[model samples]
Target: MASHRRPTHSGLTHSARVTVLSAAAATAVAALGATPAGADPQTSPERARAAVDRLFQEAEKATERFNSASERATHLREELGQVQDGVARGQERINRLREALGSLAGAQYRSGGVDPTLSLLLSSDPDTFLAQAEMLNMVTERQHSALQDLQRAQRSIGQLRTEAARDLSDLERSRAAVARHKRTVERKLAQAQRLLNSLPSEERGAFDRASRSGRGVLPAVSGDAPASSRAAAAIRAARSAVGRPYVWGANGPSGFDCSGLVQWSYAQAGVGLPRTSQAQRYAGRQVPLSEARPGDLVTYRNDASHIGMYMGNGQVVHAPYPGASVRYDPVRMMPISAVTRV
Candidate 1:
């Protein structure tokens, strides 16, 4: 037989080829092990920023819900107070009526010894005759009237008590809603913060620079005159708050949310607006976006969850989001829900 030998290729021994294949398999395993589980190897900074922006928008929506619930709770508290006061006043009236009826009963019992009509007519003293006559008339007519009044007061009190109970229940539900919305806002903001933190330092710096560039700049209005004097005043008020930080549910000189900024600006012009964005959407006459003027309320998003004061020239002054401030943006930054002329 011919000399037997292990198969070999490329002038390498069979055992050496086996060793090389084993090493390549180990390298592949190591590469797979080095990557974190469920992580995308090609995630980009733009995707992260977009996610952060979405979270901020979600947080703003929750903030509006919180504001609405808080306002409802306040209204319920006032209504409950009024109902309680009415109940108390009704109870007082009922007590006085009962005392009056008791006195009338006592008078009738004391005069039970004689016929009331005969006693009154044959009385020697004029004063006693008048007193007994008046009492007899009151016993016939005023007695029935007082009883009816008492019944009415009792019914009114019962209705007020029922209202109070209903309001209390509503208030509790509103409070719970407020708390739930608050948690949602906090959670969303936290998620946004985490996304921001995950970004590279250069990207984060670029984002901060972009935010700064957008804020504190009041672009000139295009129109020579406002739609009205109140509108002019509101535009001035909004322009004055360009650099104020955005705060959820805050309507103030220092900070504001989207609708809060609009509400506060209009309030400075002696115009009252609703507290939340959705309500403010219908607070005034609706106008088309093309006809929007300075101080017109430009509501955004299909749900009208965001609002800004139009500053003419296709610009709007709005508190954009939590990390942003009162700033100027294009009127069409998001979808135009409504243009309200307040």
Candidate 2:
């Protein structure tokens, strides 16, 4: 049976980064799946947009994770190298001790070069010879102690060798794991880059005009500061749970894991996204980022591994991982992946 595994948002799919043509193109409509025209489009579009931008941003964030893993792998390998060196040195000490013990046992002791039983029996003073025999017993005890120490050193060297071997195996696995993560991150970055590249330069003006249609006659992107709106308000609601801690598979206004928070936020906005980041990113519309809005979903890391909600101003609301709460972050920190306007 397969153990439930934690989802790792690392990189992207090979073809994830394709571009889009127009903001109102069929892809956008398909992604949104809700018209801004009637019947709760106003409420629903906000949710859809939030989901899309979150997917893109999460995909982009994979790159940061990939880089961090790479550095960690490198450090672990280095530490493993040092451990192996210690093992080697331990072996050398054992060998030297063994040699010293062997030589001492062979040359420093004999059945009795001077205090031989034959010599003792022939001695004129057997009493004095008995004292010398007692001294020989002391020498034998010292030799035994030295031999035991040599034996102990050999055992210790053997244990160190085994430990070093295990460390090397662990280090190799870590390095491979990091490589997989890098591949994931690259995939997301490529996807984000691809989506951004999809729109023609001429479409920029059209999106800018559309973005300005909201109430109060907002200024253009050139000098406009990001403003709060219903979408932003909804995102703020999502961000409120930051620091509440993540619990996988739990969706709560109190605390949430990554997908749970995303799922709950969309639920609040009156739309439903997939329960997982990968599935969520898969269902959204292929958007030219120029069409991205404050509430759009952003996915980051590879394979739509992690996700966040867009809050404009280059920020996101996401439950990053276990022990973490939903928080706002710069969208650039993530891959800026394809914006799926829900």
Which candidate gets the maximum lDDT versus the true structure?
1
Steric clash count of candidate 1: 0
Model 2: per-residue Cα lDDT over 1-342, one tens digit each: 000112222232212211223232323434434334443332332333333344334443453344345556667778778877877887788787778777756664564445455666787897888996787677677778878877887787777778778877877777787677667755644543333243344333332233222213222222222223444545655756655665544668787656667777767767766666666676556565565676667776555666676666655667654323455555555555556666
Alpha-carbon runs more than 4 Å astray in model 2? 1-20, 23-61, 64-68, 71-75, 108-128, 203-342
Q: Cα miss at 285, model 2 (Å)?
A: 40
lDDT over C-alpha atoms for residue 25 of model 1: 28
To one decimal, what is the Cα RMSD in angstroms of model 2 from the true structure?
16.2
Tens digits of per-residue lDDT for model 1 on 196-289? 5644454455556556445666688995467899999999999999988989989998999988888899899999888999999999899888
lDDT of 2: 0.54
Query: Candidates' lDDT values, in order?
Result: 0.77, 0.54
Off by over 4 Å in 1: 1-43, 112-135
- The alpha-carbon deviation from the true structure for residue 249 of candidate 2, after best TM-score superposition, in angstroms, is 27
Report the poorest 10 consecutive residues by lDDT, candidate 2.
1-10
The RMSD of every model to the true structure, in order and in angstroms, is 14.6, 16.2
TM-score result, candidate 1: 0.82
Q: What's the lDDT for residue 106 in model 1?
A: 84
Tell me how many clashing residue pairs each candidate has: 0, 48
